[model samples]
Target: MTGSSVLSVLCIYVVLTFGSFITVIKSLETQTQSHEHYSYDRVINLPGQPLTPSVSQFSGYITVNKDHGRALFYWFFEAQSHPSKKPLLLWLNGGPGCSSIGYGAAVELGPLKVNKNGGLNFNPHSWNKEANLLFVESPVGVGFSYTNTSSDLDILDDQFVAEDTYNFLVNWLQRYSQWSSHDFYISGESYAGHYVPQLAELIHNRNKDISENPFINLKGFIVGNPETDDSYDYRGILEYAWSHSVIPDEVYDTAKNVCNFENNNWSKECNAAMEIVFDKYKEIDIYNIYAPICLINTTSSVVGSDSHVSSFKRPIRIPAGYDPCYTPYVQEYFNRTDVKKAFHANTSIDYKVCSDHVFNLYNYTISSILPIYTELIKSGLKIWIYSGDADGRVPVIGSRYCIEALGLPLKSPWRSWFHNQQVGGRIVEYEGLTMVTVRGAGHLVPLNKPSEALSLIHSFLSGQPLPKDR
Candidate 1:
């Protein structure tokens, strides 16, 4: 061959050789990662926890922003059985600033929960039975998650929260490579109405690039008693209070007329009228209107504190179990030095179920999540919004209004769902969304009615319908 022809042949050979070499290296990397697990974050036992061999637990941090020294903490539980076959569900608790570990894992639906003596007890109805549970303390300042940059807390808002949570998931999946291919779902209650859908939207947008490795298989999201729209939520709170006999008709009427909930301009009369609502909720638990207020617990106030009222419409109240002491028990348990050591939390950091500081500073930018819901419905992701009929804060009345505003065609008419041979609650299906209610349950369904809530989630994840016949 001539000199030019020989040169071209050599160039092609060099390119082919490099390509094969890179492919071999990639194969080796995949094999190595597929077998990799972070043993350091594994939890063999908690300080006062019982020995339950049904599941594996791990707790640790994932740095979302290295430049800011920002990290998010997580408590992950493998499925009760055959974890590999189960879907992965990440649970968040809304406070704009609450510890998912405290509210979600320890108090509500984790395999273990805080008992009266600051010890742990096995919860048979834990949601881990249906999915691999991942509980995250998000947005830097809640629980063990932290940021070295002081100013980071000043700008906490919907956008800031979504980005951090998305980054954590991306990094977390890389570390837990075995779960990278599993179906994923997001769940939470209260302020998470904003968090859950926004994060789902982020995943939906980023996942459009099908070529990306470790693709997030976000199948759907479910939120309980979420804060969807300002006007509807405000209106719901008033109407629910009046309907439930939590407030007098005059107070509700005064606020309804004077409050410009859409514009968020609470005039002096509006403020005074709304203050009566808060003041009345203080008489009983706002989140759980039927539940009595706690007069015995001196170590704690409410679940989310008064900060919740100003930022997110209302606080978590007494966790909906009617015990009023559950929050105090869990609060005391998580703050223990040994318990902190066991959960991979910062021993020096005092873990609050909800942080007053984060709530105070959180820039409440997003007033409504319906737009994102509208967009995600088009993406064909399974979306379910559930309500505890007894939830005074995000009442069923408001949820109905919010759902109605979506303007989706009705897929199923309102009907009673059966569990334990009796009516569990009412359920209705919209074109791409589903709404469920747990009868007599309060703000936190898992805390109030674990069996029904578990059944609700099982139906949601498995693509099955709530049984009308037992």
Candidate 2:
């Protein structure tokens, strides 16, 4: 009744506790397997429209079905000349609804720029110079990216963009089987801060399914002047304007005192504060070497002669004859027999240059994907975020706020990385992640300072420390 009874009771309690724990563990494993097996019913891939003049060059396009309807994406792929080994870089341009083709082709990675005759000019700094670059006109109506059916902006959220992009990649690799062995990386700017991470998460999730999917080897990601967080991004804009003396001190103080950065909703106070700042800084030219008025009339013609143009100090435009540097020109380009033959979009009716106008009409907010950063780190993918110091839109301070939110442990002291004996940027290494700031660049890092951006990207891809040429 004493020692034996007490020992029997203790043993029974231990058995019950262990059984409960095992049941809970088994339940969790079953749920995990269920989620793994859950098939996404909406993913549908269309035919691959490959571009030519092959010669191990950059070119391709693929049709895909989005929530709105059938859409087209013009892609540019750069193949390694040596033929054996090369990485694939998927580049996206951000506007919540902008064209990657406009940004990638006219501005950043692609070799061609829109000439004054509404033609293509070859660019030497194209990302194709290093890795195979792929650009997509994403979120439907951004550029050459368009939907067949007329609807109210069907695919506007982050999830839809990620899913559609993943499906497109799978079908694309199927068409170009050679890309199956290539390593992959996702790079972009502006809203691409959101696009890149979402796509990266999708790739990581899909990799768990197919054993040989080439998209699985997604090595890393690079974002320039990324819009990661809205609260800090807007606040940072004011801080940047104030610091650069773009806004009066009084206006900056009024903004700080009246506006609530946390509530992104438009307020009279916020508007008034912004108005005051804009009124003061309206005449200050921050982007170019010229006066502020020049920045406003971004599309104005160059005043000097062709010889002077050679040494012109004006802000870069998308050449002449084409639309504004940032405007969509897919419809304009594809409508031409030459561009149609180049892209193989001949059969399509009335090509739409701007797809987002038709596909992403509703306002879509992207705020929760920040948690995906953890998923990327857990999967051993390197992530790098950089900001061009002079860009007021998505300033360096915004990046600092985003990095702080990551809660990463610093691995090295922050220092400048250089190129050609100049301070190109500063680097911060933390827990295998890298965040840097380009010294004299703007919203478009590659366009404003291609060499510096390329060097940073090359270093990240190779898993090397940022270059120090000081």
Candidate 3:
């Protein structure tokens, strides 16, 4: 029993410990594989994507209603920094039938922006810098999301959209289980104002019903230039157009007098006046009146049809600051055989920036989400409604008027928020709600003012007041 015997015993113990450690590691790996299978989604690597730091990206469909063959397509980007420690953000783009993946993820807020050359460029101010981002094409007929029951597309309504979105979240969380416990937020722009609040209401109510094993840790939502109320929104638009000098005094006055914005019923005279107003701004981009249009044709055509009146009817020239033509680049990139294969996208359907069929057949039920907002505030969830001051579509004036209607006790008076020593916009806080305005930004705040938009979202997620002084 000398030193040799003790050495032999130590060697045996070390071998046993090392073997057990290897066994444990394998067990964990097996568990992770099983979990991924249950999620039924796949992570993909794109062909032309620039080299990025170690960050995981996933794209695929989550079957919300298997019986109806309803599936929602999603592109998820993990946080650029500490993903596990960051909150999860679900971003939607309103068209009611628009592709969030096309606009929100590709052009506006995701980690990559499509270049004119059909390649990807890293977005320095991507929202994923602050939180994990998930952009979805919702409502079963938008983007890559589809339903087997073709009639299901015809019956699309706000209630159904909200319910399907809720179901998508529930199942999506199951697939990405690690995210189920993280603080969750819903965000979008344009028509998403309707989608975001209504979806939040559903999640809030559903949480109460399933309090025992709540899947969604939904903490709040942020909507940019959302279509909130038809009456107030139209009223604000008219006022904004007049104030911004987009319309002449005579046209404004005549329309203001004849238009019944409250009832949403336009008389013959009012319609005529509106036509004049539209004609006045026909040369300019309605969403961002100040921004240059991307003109593809020489002759002026109607910017949008009656059914899709929000879009520009004519092709205008792309501006220098941001390319309005970016949509076509994204559409082309997504339609590539390799890109679709990499993203696990459905190759059968053609990729479009906006779906006309979904837009035309969509049965819009609610004109305002203020009623839902009232309940959301009572639940003490963080609510933020932001607008791009330059956006003619959903002007800050309308957002301001809508928030003021909430009658929440103001926690902070209106004050300027700064980014990089420059004034970005103004922010005001209430008991449970906040409203922000991005100066010189258009309908898509992040696209026009990326840094300011980044600052805005960082402040929202951190629950800190916007920086008052540069």
Q: What is the TM-score of each candidate against the true structure?
A: 0.93, 0.75, 0.88
- Summarize candidate 2's per-residue lDDT along 1-470 as a digit string, tens digits: 79999999999999999999999998778656434322221112211222332323333445577554655465554553543466888888765655676566665656665554565565656677667777877776555555666553553677777777887787666555556678889998877787899899888877887756544578889888777777777778779888887777888898998877777564777766765654443343233212222323443212111211221111112111112233333335546665655554434545543332432343445553457787787778888898888765567987888788889889987998988789898988889578898887777677677788777777877677677667
List the candidates ranked by TM-score, beginning with the highest. 1, 3, 2
The RMSD of every model to the true structure, in order and in angstroms, is 2.5, 12.7, 8.3
Query: Alpha carbon lDDT of residue 153, candidate 2?
Result: 56
Give the C-alpha miss distance for residue 1 in model 1, angstroms: 6.0
Q: Quantify how close model 3 is to the true structure by its C-alpha RMSD in Å.
A: 8.3
Writing each residue's lDDT as its tens digit, candidate 1 over 345-385 gives: 88888877777788777877778899999999999999999
lDDT of 1: 0.85
lDDT of 3 by residue, 76-174 (tens): 999998999999999998876778888888888888878888888889999999999999998788888999989898889888898888888887786
Query: CA lDDT, every prediction?
Result: 0.85, 0.63, 0.81
**Ten residues in sequence with the least summed lDDT for candidate 3:** 312-321
Give stretches of model 3 more than 4 Å off.
1-34, 38-40, 211-213, 297-321
Ranking by lDDT: 1, 3, 2
Candidate 3, residue 446: lDDT: 92
